[model samples]
Target: MARLKTLGSRIKESAGSRVKVVSPGSWRSGMTSSQRGYGYKWQQARERYLRDNPLCVYCERNGRTTAARIVDHIVAHRGDMALFWDETNWQSLCKPCHDSVKQAEEAAGLGG
Candidate 1:
């Protein structure tokens, strides 16, 4: 399994192809200034999503009782924010389950 930093790096590489990533001290060091700002806001929104909707959305949908607290993005945060606050794109998942799901999605042409 890839580590978080490795996964994040790959994600940024794939998603930020057109955008110039430019955060000098960030894992997403290639993010541009404005995009980094947006990432900041998006992270805050993600925190809100996690706080507001704890537990795994997928597990909840399947009627499971997993302890999911990590907020997930249905799309991504490469170079857009039009849907940043849209509830349709948010989800919760436990650490292991989230890792599994993310891996599957990446394998199936989706970014985690």
Candidate 2:
């Protein structure tokens, strides 16, 4: 009987470099979430915004009503606090749309 290779094992076999093990308290760009301005204030603002805009804008455009779970920045902040906190730059999106479409838009430099 042939055994199926695990995804991790297959990836490791195909990839040359070992996966970097991130230590606890280690964050990308050497800055924590709070340092990135996503602290208490942002949380409170996000909650308030979500309350006011309960539906996902993208989903709504597609004629599907979905509850928004993420308050996304229409423009990439890139450490700009002004842009980060700009209410006008905010949009409510469902997890799927935010993670997939929005991420792809940002990657393609179309977002913002």
All-Cα superposition RMSD per candidate: 12.6, 6.7
Q: Mind giving the per-residue lDDT tens digits that candidate 1 earns over 1-112? A: 8767534444344554675444467445665555554467767776887777778866877789887767766776544455556678767888876779765886697863
The C-alpha TM-scores of every prediction are 0.53, 0.76
Error of 1 at 12 (Å): 29
Candidate 2: stretches off by over 4 Å: 1-28
In terms of TM-score, the best-performing candidate is 2
Please give the range of 10 consecutive residues that has the lowest summed lDDT in model 2: 7-16
Taken over the whole model, the C-alpha lDDT of each candidate is: 0.67, 0.88
Q: So what's the TM-score on candidate 2?
A: 0.76
Highest lDDT: give the candidate number.
2
lDDT of 2 at 29: 66
